[model samples]
Target: MLPSDPAAVELVTCGKIEIEGRLVDASNATLFCGISAEGVDAKCVYKPVSGERALWDFPDGTLAGREVASYLLSEAAGLHLVPPTVYRDGPFGPGMVQLWVDTKDGDDLVDVVAPRDVPAGWRRVLRAMDRFGDPAVLTHSDHPDVCLLAALDIVLNNADRKGGHVLHGTDGRVYGVDHGICLHAEPKLRTVLWGWVGERLPDEAVEALRTLRTAVRGPLGSALAEHLTRAELRALQRRLTDLLADPVFPTPSADWRAIPWPAF
Candidate 1:
């Protein structure tokens, strides 16, 4: 939806990856691979079966809708999430391509599994968020950030935020990738960003969130609204309002309480 040349695009296989086998034969409709496109430096592509929702178990417009919203939210959140690339029906089926980012510079919260695994210098990143009793800032399971992501995920109906959906760039930044399940009108938030719960957000961080909340309603929101339904747009606006109302360390939501098992 964000200025793309649908004509110049083509799907090319990436040799013998196990996933490729399932995709080429059509037995496995969803294929994940890395690509370098005209505007995209390097990106992971999610190709779903044309008109098929069985892969992620949602409706057709759901995935694409969410991708657009995520891009909007990233812009709103001051996050460096690359713009989403849409994959439509070619000779093959329906798939999606989007911008890839350097996770290292992107500030990934889930690059390490354990405190010991954290780079000695970056261990503070772990300690900084240890109050919630998790090493990683984000996870497939749930952390503060993951939970926040889930809220967006559920609002969009994104069911793909499972463990594998998150990517840790070599640059030491955690990047959240799969966004096919998104932009629904539901309150289905799921993800892992709570490692910093109770930890006061710095003044700078809080200010950034404020900027995003307002930006979403500006040109960016207007631009993205073109790709979304009226209801979806309203829903996004509502969510932003709700979050902006209370951008302090202690969120008032009842869901802010405890951490799940493995994370604790």
Candidate 2:
């Protein structure tokens, strides 16, 4: 089981580590696997600020903090989609560290996106071309976990929600990761999980948002204040209020691209 207290997880992440290797698939950011000395003995992902590539849109050295912020929001909102993450000084300077999730089958959303035949019970959102110009059908499960992820992405203003970031755990839970580009002050939400666009928000999701609305004014807000700029915090609050008021899935914005490049 994952550690329940955020402080405990932070301690584990900040302790000494033995670098396992680098994860090359993490484009624009360097990711490392390491074994911690905090006694958890679990493998963790270490993303150092110095290794992050400068992006024209996002400020440099802030991606690591954004990763931690996403975890904080997920915890406060009771979404439990993002894995536990902490920001601390690592071997390579300050960075974010998170426990690596052990997926059940190593399966990702990419599998369902272009299956030979559509999976039974899955909802197809749209028909599109894959990166190779081949035909593909974008889809997602009608499961509650998927819905919660969609709602969380909206609040986060996630600019990248690629299919590879979605994971299925052995515990029968769904997880979303790679949140370094989220929570921008600007309206930069981009995602592939739009299967429920324009649909009414589920009761569970609305209640979660209500809980988040309260947490943001209390402990959650204070914690995030250290990581995000004031303007970004205000934007998050505005998004929460808007979500609570309307409680409907949003459609793609005409002004901005709605999906990330190489959708998977």
Candidate 3:
């Protein structure tokens, strides 16, 4: 389910979905479901388009489309950070259905920890005070997968990349989830993955961006047109182009909030 493998795609797209429960903390109606197809089965998340909460800033396609678009772009970028996602009809109506990622037990890639407790090999994004008036630092592991995700976030124009969205999968691959509020035509890159601002892009990231640049110019652009405006597609291209040209993680801008609220 990490990649858009043929089987993973069919499993999520052709499988029958039975809603198991609701993810109560999600802003939208996020259903935890059991998916099964021809003896293949897996857990998945279903988000019906009708359940989307309207936002003034993003007044275009359903959030479900944005998520599918994100998955496509992530694959096109060669990062494979997003899980297999398909936009389809569900019990409640049409929505985005994605294969669930089982996370590593007792493992975390991002956290808000006391400055003294910052782990080795972790990158610190910000230092502040917690709700209890204790010193805290926003940090994430320096794993290549996490770094690639940070790169992808910049191109996706992700409006939300909370700590809880980054997963260290049991499969040993890192994954990012909850991309409903992304791909707007504007620069809305709020995230907890800002730990590498101003750092040189990793060689792998440079290659991935190059791959994404070409994709944005070709098939990827055409497919994204279904979910994004021409303007949004153009914006996405510009982001990739700029990254390739600069080859560095960017510093946050003052014009907008750099990090999402409830960072976790």
Candidate 4:
């Protein structure tokens, strides 16, 4: 599961899933599962649609499909930022199952640090005072992979890109997880990755966007329509077009809260 290769998909899709435990901190029922297939085994997270909580903006029982859609979009763009995810039947019914990505301990891509102690290559996001009235700043690494994730969040219209959702994989890749509130028609892009606002996107991200533009027009668009509405699909196309025309990280919008509360 750590490497999350193409075989992981087959394992997650056809493997027998055993509920190992539950991730208690998740808002919904997120099960830690052990999957076995033809003598192969791996770990994954299973989120049953029946456990999804209703949201005022997002429809009920749609979060699981949205998670799968996010993974598909990431793969279509050649971003590979999201771990292999699939929507299939589980013990509790249909839901999203994603490969478990093992992280590198003590390695964090985003953090809230003392203003004076901000790392040399990190980018400052917000300057504010902590609960103790001590000065601090929200910061994230300036690594190219981190920057690419920021762009991916923009396209996803991801409403919950919490710092904890960004993982430093042991495979030396930056992975983003927990994308249930994405692919909405509205412009609700809240995230902690606002460090690169107003800057030009990395060359690789631009190429990814170009590839996505074509993919979204053909088979990808048809596939996503099964999970998303027509309006949402149109909005996705427009967002892609806009980004390709002007490839820059956008600043926070005033219409919505730009940062998710309890960011970590």
TM-score of each: 0.57, 0.91, 0.96, 0.98
> What does candidate 4 score on TM?
0.98
Candidate maximizing TM-score: 4
Model 4 C-alpha lDDT per residue in residues 12-84, reported as the tens digit of each score: 8899999999999899989999999999999999999999988999989999989989999999998999998
Deviating ranges (above 4 Å) for candidate 4: none
RMSD of each: 8.1, 2.3, 1.3, 1.0
Cα displacement (angstroms), candidate 4, residue 162, comes to: 0.2
lDDT tens per residue, model 3, 1-264: 444456988899899999999999998999999999999888999999889888899873469999999999888877889999999999999999999998877799998899989999999999999899999999999998999899888888999999999999887889999998998888899999988888998898889888888887887888888888898888988888888889888889899999999887
Give candidate 3's TM-score.
0.96
TM-score, prediction 2: 0.91
Pairs clashing in candidate 2? none
Residue 253 alpha-carbon offset, candidate 1, angstroms: 7.5
Better of 3 and 4 by lDDT: 4
Tell me the whole-model lDDT of each prediction, alpha carbons only.
0.46, 0.82, 0.89, 0.92
The sequence of per-residue lDDT tens digits that candidate 2 reaches over residues 56-163 is 989888998999999999988877888888888777888888877777664555444565666777767678777798788887677778888989999999999988
What ordering of candidates by TM-score runs from best to worst? 4, 3, 2, 1
lDDT of 1 by residue, 29-125 (tens): 4554555434442334455545345544345445654564575566466544334455443335444544444444444444545545654333122
